[model samples]
Every structure is written in structure tokens, then in C-alpha cells.
Target: MILGFGMDVVEIARMARILAGPPARAERFLARVFTPAERAYCDARQDRAGRYAARFAAKEAAVKALGAPAGVRWSELEVIRAEGAPSLTLAGAAAAAGARLGVARVFLTITHDAGVAAAAVILEGAQR
Candidate 1:
């Protein structure tokens, strides 16, 4: 069953500014907001701004879908792609929050275009 749903949009320019800033500041911002894998994946892309924006939106959407639980860190929710399909892998506080909420799995979708990035998330509950 569907436990929760959420969607978010981000401006590509916002992420671009953070990435294009001074090294130390950029690193700090990235480190606080994104996981290592997510940083690697987006940094490897030609359109890093779009990729990062999409991932940012995905993280926000995941948190909203998870009911904005306390102590859920941003880096704990990773946006992963396999064979071009996007999904969420929660760890740390995010995983614990999901467990508490009975979220069996989280479905994710992300898209970017026209200087904007968007993501949608659906939290599925465990079978009773």
C-alpha cells in the first residue's frame, strides 16, 4: 500500500552556484547535503548542475514522503540510478525513520529540463 507521496522542484542555477563557488565552500555545501556516491555520480556528468539539482529535489521529495521525521539527515537519503532507472537507498537516520514508519520501499523518479529539475517519491508500506 502507499504510505506517502511527495514531489519537489529545484532550479538548476541554484545548484550551479553552489558547485561553482570557492572550493572550500562548495565542498562544505556538497558534503552537508549529498552522499559520496551522489556527489561522484553528479560530478561525473557533463550536466553536473542538472544532475545535482535533480538529486537535490529527490532528497527533498524523499524526506517529505517519509513524513519529515526528526533526525533524518540529508546525506542519509541517496538517489541511485541503475540502467537509467532511478531509486532511493536510505541509510543512517533516514533508514531508521523509514523503518519506524513501516516503509517497505521507496519509489523515485527524477527529470530535468529548461533549467529546472523535478523529482517525485512514493513510500510503500509493508504488507500486513
Candidate 2:
């Protein structure tokens, strides 16, 4: 069963500008909004802006699908890529929100093109 759904989009240029700002500011921004693993993943790519933008959008979409639960941190929603397949790993407040909502899993899809990144998330509830 579907518990909720959400979608979000981000501008690649905007993300690029933030990432290209002063070293300290950029690091602070990244550390505050993204996990170390997500930073590593995006930094390893040549198109870092696009990768970061997509992941950012994914996080936003996940939060929206989860009903914008209070006190949920950005790092709690992680976008992971293994063997070329992308997936989400929830932790901390994000996991708690899922449990509270009876969500068994969250499906995620992300794409980037034309200087924009987009993501969609679907919260699936456990069968009774």
C-alpha cells in the first residue's frame, strides 16, 4: 500500500554556486545538508553539481513523502548507489518517521538533465 508520495526539482547552477563558494562555507553547507558518504559519492563524479543536485532533490522528495516530519535531519535520508542501482537508506529521525507511519519501504527515482535535477519518492506501507 502507498503511504505517501512526493517529488522535487533543483537547479544545477544554484547547487554549483553553493558548492563553489568559499572553502569554509562550502564545507559547512555540505556537512550540514549531506552525509559524508553522499559527499564522497558526489565528489568522486566529474559532474559533481549534477550529482549533488540530484541527491539534494531526492532528500527533499523523501522528506515530503514522509509528511515533513519535525526534527528530521537532512543526513537522515541517504541516497546510495551500489552496483549502478540507486536506493535510499533511512536513519535517525528518518527511520523513526517511517516506523511511525507504518512505512515498510521507500522507492526513489532521480534524474538530471537540462541543468536541472529531479527526484520522486513513494512511501510504501506494510501489508496488514
Task: Work out the TM-score per prediction.
Answer: 0.95, 0.97
Cα error, candidate 1, residue 26 (Å): 0.7
Candidate 1 lDDT over residue span 20-99, tens digit each: 98989999989999888888898889999999999999999999998898898888999988687898999999898888
Top-scoring candidate (lDDT):
2
User: Relative to the unseen true structure, what is the C-alpha lDDT of residue 96 in candidate 1, on a scale of 0 to 100?
Assistant: 89
Residue 18 deviation, candidate 1, in Å? 1.1
Over 4 Å off in model 2, which ranges?
A: none
lDDT by residue for model 2 over 27-72, one digit each (tens)? 9989999999999999999999999999999999999999999999
lDDT of each: 0.92, 0.94
Give me the displacement of residue 35 in model 2, in angstroms: 1.0
User: Number of clashing residue pairs in every model?
Assistant: 0, 0
Colliding residue pairs in candidate 2: none
